[model samples]
Target chain A: MDFKELDPILHSQLRLAVVSLLISVREAEFTFLKEKTNSTAGNLSVQINKLKDAGYIEVTKQFSKNYPQTICKITKKGIESFEDYVKALQSYMNPGGN
Target chain B: MQPVYCFINRLFKPKFQSMQSENFSPKDSLLLIDSMINQAKNRFTENGFLYLLWGWLIFISAVSHFILLKTRLLKHPEMIWMSCWVAIIFQIIYLVRKNKKEKVKTYSDGIIDNIWMCFGICMMVLIIIVSRNNLWIYMYPFTLMIYGIPTFLSGVTMQFTPLKIGGISCWALAILSTITLPIYYLLLLAAAVLIAWIIPGYLLRKKFKNQH
Candidate 1:
């Protein structure tokens, strides 16, 4: 039986959680993601930057009421990669491919 | 035995690295995805402010128009509807504040916003057409029918059964309006707003509070 290899980028807990949340909403603020994932600002910033670097998500920075705001949106590649990752995970559970 | 152990470790080392520091299993990955998705889905809560606002506004307008017309106390009972312009201003302010406060945008929020905008445009066009042709007698029935469209679509979008039922009730009231006297049209309009907006508005508020 052969098991499909999962995408390395999405295998990490924090990165996977961020991607999962982004996929569900049209766009989410940095604070909203931090609250939902329970991740520290430093860690989430690093993970989201990794996702942005991979072209899996888009990050926009702007000022609202004189305060900096960060918004994140999932890219088309992100959705496709997430779907593929799920399929790979499924293959591990059902190695016979039935 | 020592050489065999070293070989196996080397073989699996790359796979383990790929798994990253958290090293969660495939099942755990699936569970995390499921839970995160659910959290996102459940995050939005409708305060039902607009629904209640418009619902009560229309209800009051219709009832006041009926009473004034019946008593002949005012020469222009129709002028009572001008209050809606004030409401329109208030609604704009409320929406702007809400947009500033909102941290996330859901797909359903976008869709629902468009739905209500369409409803607003339709109502404006309908009122203009009725007034231009002096078709005021047919107004309530048409208005009730228009009320049902957005309510029904919103219900389907939000998966709220009370709103669906409220929408159906509006259509039923619309049909009944045609067979009744003109004086009773105001009553029908009031009933339509009560069922389609007011009832669902309160229920939505309750659901939102509970979720929060």
Candidate 2:
């Protein structure tokens, strides 16, 4: 049986979790994501930068009440990639096209 | 024995190969997606501040207007509604602060915000139409009907049963107002605010506290 390749960018656990959260909410702040994913600031920052580099998400930084805030939003390309990844996973589960 | 081990390894090799290096199999990935979506969905909880604010404001105005009219204590019972302008200024300040403090903006939030904004604009236009046409006698029923729109839509968007019930209550009260005397219209308006805003507002506050 032939298998579809998953998007390498979304294959990792943390990255997938971030995309999944962003997909539903559309926009979230850095603190919100870090809290929800239960990830360290350092690690989440890295994964977020990677996603940004892949054009899967956009990050915005600004000051809110004298404190820095980082907001992230998923782009069209990211949404398409996420949809494709899910379809590929479905094919793996049902190789016979059931 | 060696051949049996090799056969078993060969059978599992493809499955292991299909899994991510982090040991997340297809099933695990799907589960993660489901969970994260739920987490994001549940993260939004309404504090019900605005609902209670408007609800109490309308409720007090209606009741007080009815009392002033019945007692002939005031020449202009309608003047009570002017207090709403003051509340409007307060609402603006509150919203600005709330928006500043908000860390995220969900699609549902955006839709609900627009629904209320539309409701506000509609109410303003309605007041203008009624005043210009001298249709104040028919105002209560019409106002109640308008109240139902946003209340119902917000309930559906948030999946909150109380707000849905409140919306239905507003419509029922509107129908009842049409059959009653014009003098009693203020009471019906009071009832609408109590049901549609106050009760749901309190319940929403409780839910927000519990969730937070």
**Compared with the true structure, what per-residue lDDT tens digits does model 2 show for residues B1-212?**
34433443354456547443444566678899999999998875589999999999999999999999889999988899999999999999998888767777899999999999999999999989999999988788999999999999999999999999999999999999867999888899889989999999999999989888
Chain A TM-score for predicted structure 2: 0.97
Give one digit per residue, the lDDT tens place, for model 2 in A9-89: 787778999999999986899988899889899989988998999999999998888999899999999999999999977
TM-score of 1: 0.92
Best by DockQ: 1
Which parts of model 2 are misplaced by more than 4 Å? B1-21
Model 1, A1-98: lDDT tens per residue? 56566787787889999999999999999999999999899989998999999999999998878889999999999999999999987876666787
Score every model by TM-score.
0.92, 0.91
The prediction achieving the highest lDDT against the true structure is 1
RMSD of each: 3.6, 4.3
